[model samples]
Target: MRSIWNGAVSFGLISIPIKLVNATENHSVAFRQIHIEDGSRIRHRKVCEVEDREVTTAEIGRAYEDADGTMIPITDEDLASLPIPTARTIEIVAFVPAYRIDPLQMDAAYYLAANGVPAAKPYTLLREALRRSHKVAVAKFALRGRERLGMLRVVDDVIVMHGLLWPDEIRAPDGVAPEAGVTVRSKELDLADVLMETLGEVDLADLHDDYREAVEELVAAKASGGEAPSAPVADRTGRKVIDLMSALENSVRQARVARGEAGSADVGADADADVKPLRRTAARKRSEAASEPPPSRKKPARKTAAKTTAAGGAAKKTATKTVAKKAASEAKKSAPRRRASA
Candidate 1:
């Protein structure tokens, strides 16, 4: 990458020579204006409105208009001779905790590198110091003829300079935030927390510009003489916007569903209450079936077939024996007492 600015970082009496390279870039496609009638490129010309004639680049000059509409031309040479201390050096104004700097103030970033081998030591020292202390250096520098406020910090072991918006440049967020006295419910907050929990951790790598991709697709289709893609359907469902509490609750419920949890905000509130009993009854049945002994695992019964047969046989044998003895005695008695005495 080409270095855009050559400057030095100044703090106290020390100056570390550094070269600045733009940290970010745009990947957007550029479109040129064309004539719809002839499909030809459209060209614009510089013209003098007062003279009604064409003007060249060399004839153009920067000018300031007075309150009375008097135009006073300012020469490029006049503006170039002004004293700008920030032009050659980025002067450190203060070293403050990184968190103290608002992200809204950041505008553009640049990668800082030592201009030469000799400047590397001091650059490394400052980078390490910022990394260890977790601090950002508020600095001032001039770029493109404008003096700019900036923050210098270490990003991924490399020192970076970010141009910051001026105090007047940042608008108060009072108009952007919710109106005062518009209270939020604890229930709503709880549901929002649940939604956040369901959302899980953020990974910026997963985020992308779908609009850019769609634009490229549209261009490709048009270039190939194919049918143009249809526009995306706008969501007119004000369900979320109209009811914050309900929306948060639904979001939480949907996230739970995604995570395979039991929840349905759209369903009745008593739905859970009704579901629990069925779950319990099913669980109880399972437990009862588990507790009951298996037929194969049971001990033999007291009235089993073999035991019943043996008992009946024993009773019959005793009865028959008794009857036979009684009959013998009776016959003896009937036959004669004399025979028994003999």
Candidate 2:
């Protein structure tokens, strides 16, 4: 790959000549502006306001606009005269733990390649030192026209540099979090933990850009003069969830189903409600009563009485399991009742 910048890394008295190349690339579909009526391509022209005519790149110059709306012309010669030591060198200012660098300050990333055969020793040495120390080098370098802060760390066998915004550039997250009045229940937190565990970790390499793929497919269909491909519409029930506990429980079950752990049972009729959230509402009590088997009126025969005893034992066992599952929910609701009584 072609390098964007050529510079030497200044580490104390040692200097390693290196080339900087971008670490990431954009792969997105581009669209051009066109005249809808004439089906003609649209192009923009640059014109000077004073001259009122089109201008070439050679005629253009850089300028700084003041807050008072005055334009100050800045020539290339004027910038070149500036005394900046980091103009062509990546100067290592300090070494710091990787966690010390705020993620919010992270910007563009680049790989530092050894510029020449002689520079390989120092490059490898720096990479090994950074790896053994478990730290990153804070650096200052000039690229394009401005000086930037960077973090140097080892990625595999290569030394990579990540551009970072200055601490002052990061905005304070004032009024960004949720209101203080909102509260999360312990039951809700438990359900959220289960949901997290169900989803678990994912391999980033296994993921792909679905939107980009869809756009590419659309473009291909248009180019071939064929009807655009259709995708199956997702079933979206326009339901607004009012209960946080119910939502979290449902989310966990859905995540488990998506991971294909419970086979088809999760989406089937006989799926177990082992982790069901129990709410102490009037509607819930009514629903629980409705689900229970009603009492039989007729007296039982001797043989039937034995069967009835066995059924009673089984019912007691099931009730015990239910109580155990609802223990936390019951404790939470009973606390208020006890307080009221006291």
Candidate 3:
């Protein structure tokens, strides 16, 4: 994995030089905007709001706007001069039990690798300590001009850091979650328990992304033959949701069928139909041949150059003839004066 950032894990006085790499990546297939009828790719441009025209990077600048609508243009120099220490030291503030750090507070995950041989020993020491103690080090660091809180823990025999949200950043769930006074039947709870027990502990890797797989299959099937597949219509007949007890019972039955404990669940007519994954840099280099006007096919040839030289020759000849005519006229007038003197 390519290291995105290079820094040190400040374990007290010892700095374990390490490089940070992203822990995860999105594998979902992405689709771009395309015209349906023509299959033409639609390109987007960065247009200036005020100018109402497309603008290039050279025309753009970063700015900070005030509450009063005042925009202060900022530069790279300004960002570099921010008060973050140049050392890029990730300070281990404290070690607390891993359970103390809420998963909701975690933002992004990154893996840290020792930069060199010297840092390896200290890095291993910290990793082992955290592993034995069942604790995660709370780290404080600055990245991209912002102070960040992170939890450092040992994962897969390597040190991983989860970027954390500040206390104020984590919003209160006061009004979001429904109040727990809703009556749930004991029977429903039993069914839920059965479903959970049946499923047991699932390895995340064992699960298949059915939607994505179906989408890919549909695309492949369509592409194989020129025939465009018919779109699958969603079941939106406005069916009323069944009672909670019935729903729980139905879910448990389905789960049992999926696990092969019971008979197969009823399949619809379009059950086998592939559902195409519904997930939806190149500088536009002007193709010289296409973008430019085809080289003037009627280019002035070498014959044109010869014509120009001939035209110059003709002009020179005309000048010589005029000079000769002037000289003859002077000679004729001088001859008459010479005859009168004789």
Q: Which candidate gets the maximum TM-score versus the true structure?
A: 2
What is the lDDT ranking, best to worst?
2, 1, 3
Estimated TM-score per prediction? 0.70, 0.77, 0.67
- Poorest 10 consecutive residues by lDDT, candidate 3: 276-285
Residues 1-342 of candidate 2: C-alpha lDDT, one tens digit per residue: 999999999999999999999999999989999999997999999999998999999999999999998999999888877899898899999999999999999999999999999999999999999999999999999998899999999999999999999999999999999989998755555566667878999999999999999999999999999999889886555445656776777677788788886667567523234446633446445555666788765555766898999999999999999989799788999999999999
TM-score for model 2? Answer: 0.77
| Model 1 C-alpha lDDT per residue in residues 32-79, reported as the tens digit of each score | 999999989998988999999999998988788999999998886766
Q: Which of 1 and 3 is ahead in TM-score?
A: 1
Q: Could you arrange the candidates by TM-score from highest to lowest? A: 2, 1, 3
What would you estimate as the lDDT of candidate 2?
0.87
lDDT of 3 by residue, 70-127 (tens): 9999997887677765338899889999889887898999999999999989999999
TM-score of 1: 0.70
Consecutive 10-residue window with the lowest summed lDDT within model 2: 269-278
Clashing pairs for model 3 are 215-276, 215-277
Comparing 1 with 2 on lDDT, the higher-scoring candidate is 2
lDDT winner among the candidates?
A: 2
Clashes per model (N, Cα, C within 3 A): 0, 0, 2
Q: How many pairs of residues collide in model 1?
A: 0
